[model samples]
Target chain A: MGQRTMSDQELVQLYLTGQEKALAVLIARHQDKLFSAIYVLVRNRAVAEDILQDAYFKIVSTLKGGRYNEEGKFIQWAMRIARNLVIDHFRRGNKFPTVTDSEGNDIFTYINIPEENQEDRLVANERDSKLRQLIEQLPAEQREVLVLRHYADLSFKEIADLTQVSINTALGRMRYALNNLRKLIEKHNIAL
Target chain B: MTKKITQERIIQFVYGELPFEETAALFDELDNDTEGLDYLESVAGIGTLLGSLMVSPSKAIRDNVLAFSAHFTEE
Candidate 1:
């Protein structure tokens, strides 16, 4: 079977045995979800890219050092690393990530699906940036729950375990997040 | 008697985290409740919007990572 079709565990084994592409396959499989998950929390493209790169190096280091315990999903482990890095960024900045970067650019665009025209692309970018700002405005806890559940691809139970809360608490936070986002959209009249 | 479908349950249903049986149960319970259905739509609607907002790392960044992986053992 092709490495692309293999399970993550199988890929890890192949990567261990000197197949570099196996590692590439694994990164391709999870990068979008992982990067997007981090981006949502950190709220900046440049910083998210940095965290993702650092997370990749950390992931490679751990795998090479024979320290990764493959008891759970690989993405979950990577998610934890990226998450801690984002938290570190928050501590360093002494606040939640601002929506814009140093030069005031919000360059969050999909990796695939190229836009047809500059006007349409600009419009979409503006709308998406507005939505992300609204997301930034969510209460931190609720936003965390939303990112963990939606972007991290974690179940509410997994989120509860990660966040040290009950499943009900996680679920409640997600519900609040959705409702709050709805209100934000209405209040701001965001097109999306 | 129908169990009242809570927003939390709707949230799970919307996210596809709810089990099939439970989803069918909620699907049935929500069939007659316009407000519940609308709430489900709102949750799902926002989720779709959020999904669209996701961005990918630039190609150069990914290439750099792949290169890092390629020579990781040699370094």
Candidate 2:
């Protein structure tokens, strides 16, 4: 099989063996999810993009510096780095950006959905946009849990550790996220 | 003895975070209660909808990261 078909672990091994393209392949495989996780927190495309690049740079340096020892969790490690950068950015600024600026533009504009039919695609896109809006409407903590769980693909335990909350709190936030989303779907009659 | 099934437990069950025994217990409870089953379906459906949305950084970001990766080599 080609490098395209290699598993993440295989790609990491290949990169370690001096095949630079393997690193490219691995980044391609995870950029979207990593970017999404960052955007969910920063809510600004430009800032998220910068943070993603910085995170990738750090990831490469870590790999080269022999500091990255996680065998099959390169993506998770990269995500943790990106998340920390985002937190630092906010902490330094001492203010988190609003979910949307006065112009109401947000990262959801970057979502690209694929579907077979034009009508179905439009409907699906609308549903997705509505869902995204609802998620943005969720309380910050709830949205953070949901984003970390789904976008970052972190476990509830990891989320608890990262957010410095108990596992029950993390799970509770996820439960409330779902419940609130359900309420919003019903309230708005969103067909999903 | 049976444990009470809260929404938190249902969320854990939906996300595959529950232990196998708790999962089995939840499944048993759901098998007996239509409302519980429906609630689980609703939660899971929202999850499915959330999963359908795909967000990515712009092409510029992807290209920049990939280009940087391509040029880096461990010395």
Candidate 3:
């Protein structure tokens, strides 16, 4: 290919056609988002990192073998792989062990603060950590709907399609998620 | 010419999940009912907060992803 950048679909096509550069580009493009999603599920940096590697290896192998057919969906497919790896990691008793890295410990511990202005960057980070904690409190079904809808930016119809639920059910789950979160915030006196 | 709206329908209204006629009717109800209006506002606030819940990965996560990506580059 020329200096022109390729779309995810094009990269996938090239990878399927035995181009090594395509896989690298695709991995480079999605590595961060995939890792973030995996981190949410697994809650451990090292484990999430390990799972990301497994996900990339699987993605390259599957694409190169022509096993993945959906176009423009490389990230979603890679995320599915990463998610499965995280689930398997948890199933196998994976644990975080307290973070030893000073920077890692600081970021992870910053979740405990309350009453910060959104205009401040550090406060914005605190808000994110609070939201993640709120999500963890949600029931699994509702949590899944919230993550798929908000984080993945999947439409309700797309989520229903992915989760094999009816559109109405997906909407209802989101409704419940919001209601439950509202209750949790009130009960815990969590400042938003 | 309007049907009474319930709290349950407020979410669908705010999120635009309702059909056009229902949305119009809900707005009409809001104009006449203070309680419905308050409920609508609360639900909207919840939606706003929930919508902001996407968290950026922590530094460790960033480092891990970068390192993991580099491995693919190396191999």
Candidate 4:
């Protein structure tokens, strides 16, 4: 079996067995969802990068120390680790201290959108930026639920269990998050 | 009598976490309820917008992570 498709569990086992590249495969497979989950919560590229690094460092420690016994998906386990790092960040940083985007160089904002003229793309870009700003403005609790549900793909029950809140609160926050975003979009007259 | 849709069920329904029969039942239920329909549409739209959201950490950060794995040379 020269070229075998490895499951996440197999990749972890391979990495444990000293095949280092397996970890890279695991990271690459889930980077989009994992990084997006952290980025939306922190709302800054640099901080998100920091939290991601911290989360991965923690993952390495736990796995290498023979302590990672998480059942189910590796991405879910990684997502929880990332979310915990974000929570710790907020706790340490005096509760959402208006982080400025020092690394405002997301390559996606460059010539990314295909099949659109410059003017139309520019309008869409403005709308996207506005939406990002509104998401940033959301209360941290609301944003947490939003990310866990939309990005992490967690049900409200799981979110509630992790967050130590009632399922209703989780659902309520999600509703309010969307409603607030909708209101902000209307207030700014930004069309998506 | 129409079933009263709680916020919990609506959220589950929105995420398609509800069972097949329950999902169909709520779909029909939501069709008759404007507020529920609006919530469903609102969240679905916002989910799409949020779905487009993502950011990649710099290569340096990812390298640092991958490099950490190399430190473990033995099983």
Listed in order, the DockQ scores are 0.62, 0.57, 0.23, 0.53
lDDT of 2 at B61: 73
Docking class of 4: medium
Q: Which sections of candidate 3 miss by over 4 Å?
A: A1-7, A17-33, A94-106, A109-127, B1-75
TM-score: the better of candidates 1 and 2: 1
The stretch of ten residues in a row with the least summed lDDT in candidate 2 chain B is B1-10
Off by over 4 Å in 1: A1-4, A94-114, B1-5, B73-75
Tens-digit per-residue lDDT, A99-138, candidate 4 = 3244443334433344268776666555555677788888
Candidate ordering by lDDT (highest first): 1, 2, 4, 3
**CA lDDT of every candidate:** 0.80, 0.76, 0.63, 0.74
Q: Candidate 4 on B1-75: residue-level lDDT in tens? A: 222345457767778777888888777877778887766776677777776665455678778988877774334
Please, what is the TM-score per model? 0.89, 0.79, 0.65, 0.81
C-alpha DockQ for predicted model 3: 0.23
- Sorted by DockQ (best first), the order is 1, 2, 4, 3
lDDT (10s digit) by residue, model 2, range A139-178: 9899989988888888898888778899988988887888
Regions more than 4 Å wrong, model 2: A1-10, A69-72, A89-111, A117-119, B1-5, B73-75
Least accurate stretch of 10 residues (summed lDDT) in model 4 chain A? A106-115
Candidate 3, residues A27-101, lDDT tens digits: the string is 666665566566555555556666777776676556545567675366666666766776688688865333424
Number of the top candidate by DockQ? 1
